[model samples]
Target chain A: MRIVIIDDSGLRATVLEEGLRDAGYDDIHIVPPRGAFVARLERMAPDVVLMDLGSPSRDTLEEMLMVSRALARPIAMFVDHSDDAMIGAAIDAGVSAYVVDGLRKERVKPVLELAVRRFNAFAKMQTELDEARTALSERKIIDRAKSILMNQRSLSEQDAYALLRSSAMNQGKKIVDVAQALITASDLLGGGL
Target chain B: MSLRIAFLPLTDAAVLAVARERGFAEEEGLSLDLIRSTSWATLRDRLVYGQVHAAQMLAPLAVAVTLGLSQQPAALAAPYKLGVNGNMLVMASDFAAALDPDTGRRLSDPLGTAHDFAAAIGLWRRKPVIGVVHRFSSHSLMLRYWLASAGIDPDRDVVLRVLPPSLTVEAMRAGEIDGFIAGEPWGSAAVEEGLAETVAIGERIWQRGVEKVLAFRTPWLEENPDIVDRLLRALIRSASWCDDPANHDALAQLLSDPRYVDQPADLIARAMSGQIVVRQGEAPIASPDFLLFSREATPFPWRSQALWIYSQFVRWNMVEHGPEALAKAGAVFRPDIFRRALADADVPMPGANMKVEGALGLPLAVGSRKGGLTLGPDRFFDGRVFDPERMEDYLTNFVSPL
Candidate 1:
């Protein structure tokens, strides 16, 4: 299977290439840390893709999801994370899978297996965390949203949150979206939502 | 006006289901369309571009959005909290057993798991790594929180990495990971399959803290206040239904639907019921439920909870670059909108300093349910007594206005 690994991690790409080669499969190309990933991955046009979870920004992934979803040029092939359930879990966690349209499962399993392994490696590190407070990388957004809710709706802490939670439910939205909305709303509402 | 919303699939995604099912949006004279988003970034983009009016999002994602992490013109805003404490920390069973049986069977504090976890890393000589679903999730923060509290430097001491929830269990059993922190059922399933054991529930440590929130574009809410209000009312109702014990089964079925957790209905139901089977070759046993979709469990947003999150943000340096982090958090966390929604629904809102008892009592559903006889605590970590009025200063401190 001619595969292109679109990932930001060198170790992951190496590990996957090695594993796939070991499994008697080799037509593999690695794309490491490049901007405009969608364009490059498509330019490469490999039969299968072994992408990494948490590799790029949410915007990047969303673009990829849309590109794959809309164009059907690349279907969301499963990550080598483990199995179908794990890929679903990744999707739930905001990661996605893309494959070339009409790619057969046999053509992708080798690539998927490697992607799953690398994804597994990352999962190993994460499970050992034993708690969820590790995201210094992503805390800025949550705090900003909380602050907006507090200032705008005149919400006293939890009430602002209830506003967020209820909004998510009533609007069938995500908490993050509700938070983003409140900040946007505050800006438009002139500091009061 | 019709507002578009993108929802990530999780137990908490029920807000979307409840909103649509309850007809709250229609009642408010607003058109609602919920798009099931596969990833957080997609949800964020759809919401940001006005493609979707709102979303069921990560609490931290909203905060991150407002801070301009995504470099978007729009910022996530709202004091509205989506949900709380539907997370768990899990370890493979053999890994747990290897964690020094010398510590004795009767153990307190999940830190024991951490200690054993560190030891397991050493014993297995496995990478001292763990998995979280995303970089910007409560699981990541709580993993850091628990590890840091245990004096394990989350940064230097161990390698902190991100992975999808699906891989956590297999990773643990395969020795790819010694342990993991996630929403639910993953840990329980590990224990059930003899692949892992539950070290703690996020609820056990932080209690009913806000884990997720609804986010909207600032322009969207300003343009449509009535729609926002309507959205909240339905959410409040959904939260209420989730709280009822009888609805647990129904919720599990709802969540297990292909659109929700998408696992088997029974698996989703068991997780909701807190029925955990942590050992392979053994019967499934009950454990503390995640209480994601549970009600009364949903509303009553706690400033203390928000403050708790902010403290961690400050502790980790995630609060920088924002003007008056505390004020910003205060501004975003809206008790006002919450009260309006709950009051409109005729549900008595819990005080900002309310000391309400947990709806799910300890010793879940009766005599002799395995793992000894015990009930979950109704207390906080400080043991100084949790009070809302006292938490204001701390929460306000989350973002000190410049």
Candidate 2:
């Protein structure tokens, strides 16, 4: 079966392509975000199309359905009646599929399942990367706030840290939030270390 | 009760936003979880698969989904109309110059400009590509209706490209499309940027025409009558608030939030107040009744309006016209539920479920349960009437280009 994946992110498309390749499906095409996507897909009439649910071009595909003459065989979304859980999972994972009408469900199920699994993996990796970046920035902010406190109040580093923790607890906010507030106040008051 | 509702960011979605932000939903003991969708296709899927309790949807899309034109066949119903007559057709400057030079007159006389558009097709650089929001959208159906009247085959003489309403301006700037027909703020944005000029307004094509409706899955609506009634009541109160002239400023400011329509406040205000700037740097033209949310029973979903949409499907060969298909399509608009929800309230309702569409030449007060109910003029520009009893004659009247 021929499959085409439409996604704007190159890395996500490459990962999905690699997963499909490993599953013994050789005819795979990746169409990135570019001009005239519908025309490109028309030239390569794939049996099944995999697309990111967030892509705005999905409406373009709907237009193709209206002008049926443009397509070889009318394509419909691959929504299996017997498998509601799998379909819901695919939607939650931001994956959608459109297969040429009369294509067997048995042939399309595995391909969609593989896409869902790959998309979830990519999402988890992205979340981890974002969290790591945020944590590093918060740490730097907290260190700067502690040093300013130590210099302005003539207190030790340990005492400064305790002061920030108590202030955060009193204000019902996070330590990073309190630390950021301290840094802003110090800069505004011309007392930056 | 908490209900999740899906909607696109457009001026017509004002009712839902007002319902949630202004405490109308809370007053009825309901919490509305509004999910902003990027495309109508995704919004349909969300409502079809039980992700949302309801959605603000295109009228024909609700019918098309019931008929199973796209995706799996799922029965959907629209008990309340979100808004009416808020869409516009805009053409690029170079192509528009071929038509009437006076932009105000161009929109005022759509029939005359349509012929001019037909004559200008041969003078263009290439095939004119017009952007529509969706295949089963009201704007697309209206474009086809207006173009066919002037001997322009929408499918052959010109190209209909589908783009999201928000992306229409960018696409026009990129020269990917010559023009687009979409709901407000987007059309106003295009005109403000001097990229396009207004050719026709939907109100003139078919005055008080059906646009967006509050759609819900059939099974879900049947299972929870109490919840549905409460939500409709909330929407009724919200719609009244949106229609008031005194509230337009506050309403525009609320819609300008980044979480909603997310355009400039002044640009969004122009559509709500009906002071449209059709051309770049031109003085605003006052066209009151340009967009109506609740005035004159506007929220009522007449079944005859649904039949009008069904006829268009047959006109374009989108669906095979049959009694079974016609009944199914007409059943998509649930006026019975609308009446049931407002039975106890002081709201006045039309006594009939269906009427002859485009027959009303002027505002007429019809029989109603409560007193003081008047419907405004709803006439087609070509002076053709669509009577639900004579669907065959209406379909035969449109002479297709052989």
TM-score of chain B of each: 0.80, 0.99
Per-residue lDDT of model 2, residues B1-402, tens digit only: 899999998998999999999999999999999999888889999999988999999999999999999676799999999998999998998998899998778888889988999988889988999999998999999999999999998989999998999899999999999999999999999999999988889988998899999999999999999999999999999999999999999999999998899999888888889998878999988888789998889999999999999999999998999999999999999999999999987788899999999999999999999868999999999999999999999999999965
Best by TM-score: 2
Candidate 2, position A186, lDDT? 94
- Model 1 earns a TM-score of 0.60
Lowest lDDT 10-residue stretch of candidate 2 chain A: A62-71
> Alpha carbon lDDT of residue A125, candidate 1?
58
In candidate 2, the residue pairs with backbone N, CA or C atoms under 3 Å apart (3 or more residues apart, or in different chains) clash, namely: none
- Angstrom error of the Cα, residue A5, model 2: value is 0.4
Error of model 1, residue A35, in angstroms: 20
